[model samples]
Target: MILILVDALRRDHVGTYGYHQPTTPFIDELGARGVVFEDALSQAPQTLNSTASLFTSRHFPLLLWGVEHDPIPGVADDRREQWARTPRLAAANLTVAEVLSAAGYQTVALFNNPHQHATSGFSQGFDSARLLDRDAGQAYARVDSLTTAFLDWHSGRDPERAYFAYLHLMEPHNPYRPPAEYQALFPPGSGRHLYANGPPPPGFTGSDLETMTALYDAEIRFLDDGLRRLVGELELRTDLEKTLIIITADHGDELLDHGGLGHGKTVELELLRIPMIMTGGPVGPHAGTRVEALVRNIDLAPTIVEMAGLDEPGDFQGRSLVPLIDGAEPAIEPPEISYAWIAELRSLTSAEWHCMRDLANGRLTLYHRSEDPRGTLDVAGERPEIAELCLAALDRLEAEGEEARRTAEALKTVETDGAITPENAAVLEQLKALGYVEE
Candidate 1:
């Protein structure tokens, strides 16, 4: 099975999701052949925390942000003494890959996102957790090339082997530099042009929106081409009849939506809602059926394990997608989606409301999703019950998550210097370029 992660892909930007541009013809086609999540949400706004939850099937607050030797408060940290004592895989946590490996599936991870690298302890269970080709700083760079190469390599290997591969592609993330040929869609004064040139130019204008959107669309096209290639290759060699393929993203990016450029710093829907598609085996051809029920990033790991016919480890916070894939009505109630923004915003969400508390200060902003889907208007004063429920959920999830973090930390023996490693230096560079990091 092949799992492709398209980093920072906005749900609204794709044609299937109603964007005017032909930004995602390939993905739209994929949607026609698979189930499409209309209201999928990420566990965190950023890649590191969200993906940690994805790999471990745990809540973001409980996963310690994918750094070295840190633990989720209440999980599995108490077993070890120092951070260094923690292996890439901690005692209590088991990645989907590890369980599949034991079940005799060859597991491989080829990532464009550096946080999925071994140094961050995310590569724990894969048989060949290769980081693939990347500069120390542009680890996520050229993700398409890496995906294609990995597929080629996999195809040449034993065809009879049951295998699982996780591939991450960063085509739509910022420093939005598609090739010059693709850039032709945008003029020099456009936001996409300006972003490619360097940072946001002074006094950004709305007139540039079209060109900026065009450039962004062009980048999405590039990734789409690569995705098509990978899918075609998979169809040719794999047991496409029974093999399961899942495609989704860590989060979405905001192109001047609510005045934001990148993700991880905002609680806005533009950055939170991602695309989740599961196609393969018996789940294929369930296409174009939009599932309005909310799904979280935490669900990926558990779903993967269940698909591989393995038992899910207890303590996983996500629900398996098996029932949904089987077209079974959801038996359990939907989860209350929660996100923490240490960068600037802290928020929790339920099916009815989105409540954000500024991390910079304690000012609160509440939007009733039932009343204002655009989130253009704040109604914290108008709806006290909604606000109360969101806050209470936030408080409960946060307390549990914090406890997990503490437990993980207490079990580890290592200390991180707060400096970026050579492997993560490229991620730091992109974060700075996206204005997620300063100085």
Candidate 2:
């Protein structure tokens, strides 16, 4: 199984998602041969929380905020030590790698995202795991290096053994700087200064937004070319038909949408909506199929586990998508609820509407997604019934998540004291440099 996770990749920016720009031709072609989920969302808008949920098949709040005891009760909220006290994925939780590895599949991971590095407990189940250097600067580990590492690692492995390889590409992230060739793909302009120090300067004009977006698109194109090369290597080295390939993003980015330059600050659609496409290996006859039902990133791990003919872990909160891939109705319909949590902001999205709550200020806003996909129009006052229903749903979800979290905590044999090691300090420094964690 090959899982390729692109960081901060917006769904609408891709060609398959109806964007006019040809930024992702390789991904578009892959979508044509796979099943596409029309509405897929990440559990959180930030990499740390979202990627944790993706691997554990649990919500971010449950993972980070659902501990039995607060590790540092008196520390300031902005302090690094306070954030370090947040819970990591428990050792008891069965990860996708652990399940596959137990089933005799070789598990490997090459991740560029700092949050998924070894210090975060994300490397628990992988037989081999590598993280890019903290000082790699804006581009981090480029796709070329990532692909080369995967190819080299796979070359030494036994060809007959089933294997699962995960690649997290960090291109197209903030401080977007495409190659010289790709920089010329868009109209030449100097927008680098706008986002060089994080976010466009105050009093930024609409034209400035356009220029910055063009730079981001160029980065996308550059990554697209790199993906094409990687796919070529896959075809040359392995049987494409037998390998399960999954392409998706950890979360999406916001470029002046909802008045933000980046993610993790808001639960707008642009930040939560992600692209998910699956092809090969257990997809069966569902080629070129698009399922309109809502899916979450948490569902991917369980689906991959089931596809590998292993039993889904009992603690997994997500259901398998194999039934949908086989052209049959899922025994249980996809849940109407999709959730996103970032610090004090909590969002719940339904089929036609979205509701967000600010836990700090008790502010509530609702958007009719069918009429306003961009979530610019606030209709909370106009549709009080819908808002009330969504709030009730959010309450129920939080209650259930908290209950499950406590259960998991009780099952732990060893309690974590939240001590920071040298490795964790290095990881924190990298995340702060990348603008994911605030210093």
Candidate 3:
């Protein structure tokens, strides 16, 4: 089984998702040969928060780790302490990798994102997990290097045992500089000077935004090509009759959609809605089918477990998506909840309404799901009762999530690695270069 996660990949930018440009031919082909999710939302709008849920089958807010969005008021004052407070995948949470490993599969995770390095507990259940080949200071590691790394591992692993490898690609993230050859579809031209590392570019005009969008699209194209190469190599090395391939994004990027260039700032559709595709194994029976029902990122873990014929484990909060692909409804559906730490925002998207509230300022925005899915037309004032109900639901979820987090943290108190250390300076440097920290 191979799980591919592209960082900062927007849902609407892919060819399969209705984007006019042909940025994802490879992924689109995967969708055609498998099951596609038309309405999938990430639990959080950033990598660490988003991926923690992906591994543990828990909502972002419900995770035991510190919510970095505001848990620490002065992030820059002490980088070491900040790293100490870094949102983590607590050991208390049972990860899908652990489940698969115990069930006789060799698990491996290769990623470029510094936040996902073992320090955050992201490496929990894998036989081998490491942050692969990234260059210094905002330079992305080539996708080829990552594939090579995986191949190195595959070549040495036990041939008879099944394998589960998770690869997290960073091409779609910031510093969007795909090689010139990859940019042939959308040349940089005059907008090459724009920097996408931090917040929105100052004095950014309409034309600059267009250039940013093109660069991002080109990045996706580069990612797609690398993915095709990696899959081809795997097919050659081993039999693929029982292979299971899953593709998804940690979260979507914000490209001036809500006045920002990076993510972690909001829970808008651009940041929360991601493409989830599954192919091979049991999914082969449902080829070329698209499931239109709403699904949360948390459901992915449970789905993988179910495919392995394992029952749900450790208070898993999501239902397996296998039922949806099989054209059957689940016993119970989870509410659609999306969250962001930076904005202190929490949202609930239901069949009838899409609601968002900025908890920091108590500002609420509600929209009719079918009529105004983009949430452009605010109807909070016109439909006060519905908005109130949404707010109450949001409040309840937050309360429950907080309590869950507390329990997780309490369980983690037994671990001895909580001390602050000077090595965290390097982590802060990586975070700054990656635009997680402001100057």
Give the best candidate by TM-score: 3
Clashing residue pairs, candidate 3? none
Which candidate, 1 or 3, has the higher TM-score? 3
Candidates ranked by lDDT: 2, 3, 1
Which residue runs of candidate 2 sit more than 4 Å off their true CA positions? 60-87, 134-139, 196-200, 330-335, 401-439
lDDT by residue (1-439, candidate 2, tens digit) is 9999999899999999999988999999888988898899999888878888888787742353333433322223454354465556656456888888999999899878655545456777799987755335443778888888899998898888999998998878876778778878865375443663235567787877887788888888888899989988989877787788898998888888777686778888898999999887776357899988778899898999989888887768777877767758743444556888877788998778889998889888999888999988899999999889878877887787666555434323233544455535554455457443444
lDDT of 1 by residue, 349-409 (tens): 6667788887568677898787888788889888788777767776786677666555444
Clashes of each: 23, 0, 0
> Against the unseen true structure, what C-alpha lDDT does each candidate score?
0.68, 0.78, 0.77
Error of 2 at 194 (Å): 2.6
Model 1 lDDT, full chain set: 0.68
1-439, model 3: which lDDT tens digit per residue?
A: 8888899898999889999998999999999999999888888888888888888777743243553322222123344364556666666567889899999999999877767755667888999998764554445566788899999999999999988899988988887887788778877556643655346667787777777788888999998999899888988987664789999998888777666678887777778889999988889989998988888888888999999888778657777898889988643355554443433788787656778889888999988978976667889999999999988988887887766554444434333334334544454455447443345
Quote each prediction's TM-score: 0.82, 0.86, 0.87
- lDDT computed for candidate 3: 0.77
Which is superior by lDDT, 1 or 3?
3
Ranking under TM-score, best-scoring first? 3, 2, 1
